[model samples]
Target: MPASTSKSPRVAVLADSDTRWKWGALTAHRLVPGGRLDGHLLRGRATPTPRQLGEVDEAGVRPDSVTEVTAAEFLATMARERYDVVVLALVGGGVQAMLHGLTHAWRGRERRPVVVTGYVGVVYEKVTDGLLLRHGADLVLANSRRDAERFRAVYEGVGVDASAVVEVALPFLGGAPYRPADPYTVVFAAQPSVPAGRADRAYLLERLVRHARRHPDREVLLKLRSRPGEHTTHVEELPYQKLVRGLRPPANFRLVYGHMGEVLDRADLLVTVSSTAALEALHRGVPTAVLTDLGVREALGNHHFVGSGCLVSWDQIDAGRVPVADPRWTQRNGVAPGDAYGTAFDAARGRIAALLGGAGPGVIAPYYDARTAPGYVPGLLARYHLGVDGVPLAGAPRADRPSGPVRQVVRRAARGAYRHGVQRVAPVVRRLGEL
Candidate 1:
């Protein structure tokens, strides 16, 4: 199909978190350079952190144009001003429900926008969540060929057509020129909330701090996921600051917070329990280590690093032994430069173009279509759209206030309880079972 001769396609990206917004912003940036696209960002129920807002500004997404709108407002905007495409950079139950509402609101409309959705990072778990999101989308983008294949199997198991799934490279891998780091700079990319019993965040930080002490000349940077008081999806994270308090970390040992690319750029050796940052480090030719001292295989998602030869332990880091990543594993996992994993920027551009140029309104799953009308009011009132204190503008009498902010508070409390139980009570139960 030829390019539209009239005007650029109007695109809107709905994102929940900073990292997720990056995926959308990178895609939007790629689309704009083609001179045939106009992109805007919509703040979902999860408000953007200050760092995320900064990132959007830096990505050339005009701050004036970014809108913080309710789900009803989003749907109203879509209804009033038809967009060519609406990309969802969201996750979990919130996303699944949003997709349902969007499809329902647009049902039978002559000018419905294409719905594009996908996971923000490598999909290690939550297969069901991924499937639910994909089922209602016009195009479901996968992070790699391997991921695309996995999605196909999942779709097949559920008896849904898997033709909509397409493989695209990780967006962050593009355009950043790799610069070598200073000698003996080891960066531990911290993810404080892994599945329970997989890895200990404090233990990992302690080992790295200890290693830095053993070799005072080396710099050890603990790269944090978010700054203090910043909103993030990790509800149960134990901040690295809390973990290292009173240890009196050496001057050379620092807690850093910035872009992953910049962090990896200055890392001579990148250490992680099971972070996608390892893949980025390998892409930049940094010596990478997937710490396996605490857990192995699926427990810590170290299976993905198996053939990479980058998996290591505290002893190895202490002894100044950093294992080099295998290029084969890197290539297979879609980190290596090549067509095997389509270039993220280029793939995004082409996919959007194809969706716009193709005939018909695109596929709308029967499941979402059937649930549209019945779900409109409740979906509009759902927490992702309305704050816990918010009420519908008019019409039907309010049953009970459904505010997302209140639910978020409740969810966080539950997560705290769960984490506490897992840490304190689970061990005793396991010991009793062993006896």
Candidate 2:
């Protein structure tokens, strides 16, 4: 690859959802003025559905410009084109796929794009050794100092050099100023399929309804991550609307969706069970309540909010209590919204520029090996062959072609089975259980 004649660096953001696209967009928007930024909607390993693409478009990302790429295509594109930097804005197995493909493409090559990896949310626990080992990134951007430290510790524990990890402030926090809504509104942000296995969806909604009934004048909004019938990265654990249909919700109760900034702006209070939105709400000075009725610590991961003074239980919400946020906690979390675009942002920009300017460090050897490790092969196949909807890389075996159609068929069959169980089998099962 030859050096670019243009003054600005060329960047490609590989994203699979609206959340990731937002993160990538922020990275692109903050680049030193005239850098070329292109956003791609990844298909395999963690591709976005059409509905997700629509939502991303609605959020102001140019849909026409956002190309859809599979793992093979991504690798092929990276190999064929010369990009100054390539940012990975994927989550879960998608990250593994991208890392594997990129590493495979750049193996034995002299020139390669600076691979950047980061999280779209706050890091609560130890950075997974598996993720770092498989990352294959030239740099890893941490959302906060705490996360950066965690990354360093994890890297060191895994015997990998941790110097590439850099701390950066949350970009989503730099949005519009907070404006409190009238009528004392409360928004219950719901997360149905958290990794910790907290299955209190019904209980949470019931609690919210009870809260709304107790105070008829105050508006209560059920802010869902994804509405019913909408495709999201997470599995549809519970259809919340169905649970509340028989509860006779108050006139003030409503389901809402929009930008987090807009939702929080209209919210006087936010209640949830371990959601990143809680951090966003706190950053805006909106009172928040972290529910603990189910008493599952690991599942909810709300323990991070303990010292924040925002922890509460259903008992407290029923008692009409709103938890106050601890200022020290906000500062410690690096989510202090009052920073006014501090030095962290500038530092991140400078780091990216330096990498583009050829001052960046070399790719760690462990990540290079991790891509081809036996444990990573399944994930690579899932993402590149079975998950994506694009052409396979040239010279790749026929067996490497994606089985997207088969996966879709299986998903549809599962959904159909679920509907049948609820409509036809549940009644009989309940009757037999009563006997």
Q: Which candidate number maximizes TM-score? A: 2
Candidate 2, clashing residue pairs?
A: 44-388, 45-383, 385-402
The regions of model 2 sitting more than 4 angstroms off are 1-7, 31-34, 44-46, 49-64, 107-110, 195-199, 359-364, 368-435
Candidate 1, 1-435: lDDT as tens digits: 233323655667777667777776666555444333333334332356567567655545542256555456565556566667677777655455556556556666765676777777667776765565557677777777788888888887777788777777676664353555555688988874663332376677778889888988888999887776454545434566766888898988999887777777677888887888877777777788888888676766777677889888899778878697677767667685645434454655576667666664564663323244354435433545432223223542222335468865865566456656644577678879979
What's the true lDDT of residue 4 in model 2?
51
How well is each residue in 41-151 modelled by candidate 2, as lDDT tens digits? 665322445554554444454422567665566677776777777878877456656765665666666657777778777665445844564355766777776777777
Error of 1 at 104 (Å): 2.9
Task: State model 2's lDDT.
Answer: 0.66
Question: Which candidate number would show the highest lDDT if scored against the true structure?
Answer: 2
What is the Å distance of residue 42 in model 2 from its true position? 2.0
The C-alpha lDDT values of all candidates are 0.65, 0.66
lDDT of 2 at 120: 73
